[model samples]
Target: MMELAVVWSVLIAQTMLALAMAFALYRMARGPRAQDRILGLDTLYINAMLMLITFGIRTANTVYFETALIIAVIGFASSIALAKFLMRGEVIE
Candidate 1:
């Protein structure tokens, strides 16, 4: 019974994360401004990272956690670059 409950919970969480990702994609595509689009992209990355972590928990595996970490690092770097571009029109000096 407990195992069944765990499975159901994981499924529900994954479904929710997928829905969130879809909404983020829509926001990114339908944005009225660059800032809105950037925000959407950041939200998408965050949702993806969360989904990965959930997968790690469901599977009781370290591989998924490691992948999520990599995604987090990449997402952070990309968000910083996007913010720099927005503020200074360039990501690199």
Candidate 2:
């Protein structure tokens, strides 16, 4: 039953990832301020990247790991930029 356990684990991980994504989207849409929305976006991207890693494991595709890393870097950069803008009143200020 090892094969069945593996299948169930993958399925459960995927479902949890999907629910996380949906919650992030809801937060993004309902957030009361720009910073909150940006935070939600960052959360969504991070969760998506993690979901990609899970998919990679399930499908035995190493390429997805690289993609997830890239997405994580981009998400971090965007969050930094957004936070800076919030503090300075302008992106470049």
Candidate 3:
């Protein structure tokens, strides 16, 4: 059935996102430089957002989608701040 296919696909997507998150964590932890670590954090947030999206699809819930949106907004703002800090040694002028 279509429902079964949807469930299975969402399960697979979630599994992949989990694996990606693991890799991102490793990169963030062991990165030799600030830029590499920042890149890892960026990837981690994106995977987290996608994981939430897959959960929303699986559960047919709107809350997961809204939470994912919040994560995305916060992640983007944090990444910009980090980049600015790395470049100028200050987040704000």
lDDT of 1 by residue, 1-93 (tens): 999999899999999999999999999999989899999999999999999999998889999999999989999899899999999998898
Tens digit per residue, CA lDDT, model 2, 1-93: 997898789889989999999999998999989888998999999999989988898888989999999998989998999999889978885
- State each model's CA lDDT, in order: 0.94, 0.91, 0.96
- Top-lDDT candidate index: 3
Tens-place lDDT per residue, model 3, 32-87, is: 89999999999999999999999998888999999999999999999999999999
Ranking by TM-score: 3, 1, 2
User: What CA root-mean-square deviation does each model show from the true structure?
Assistant: 0.9, 1.2, 0.8
C-alpha-based local distance difference test score of model 1: 0.94
List the candidate 2 regions with Cα displacement exceeding 4 Å.
none
Model 2's lDDT to the true fold?
0.91
Clashing pairs in 2: none
Q: Which lDDT value does model 2 have at 57?
A: 82
Candidate 3 TM-score, true structure as reference? 0.95
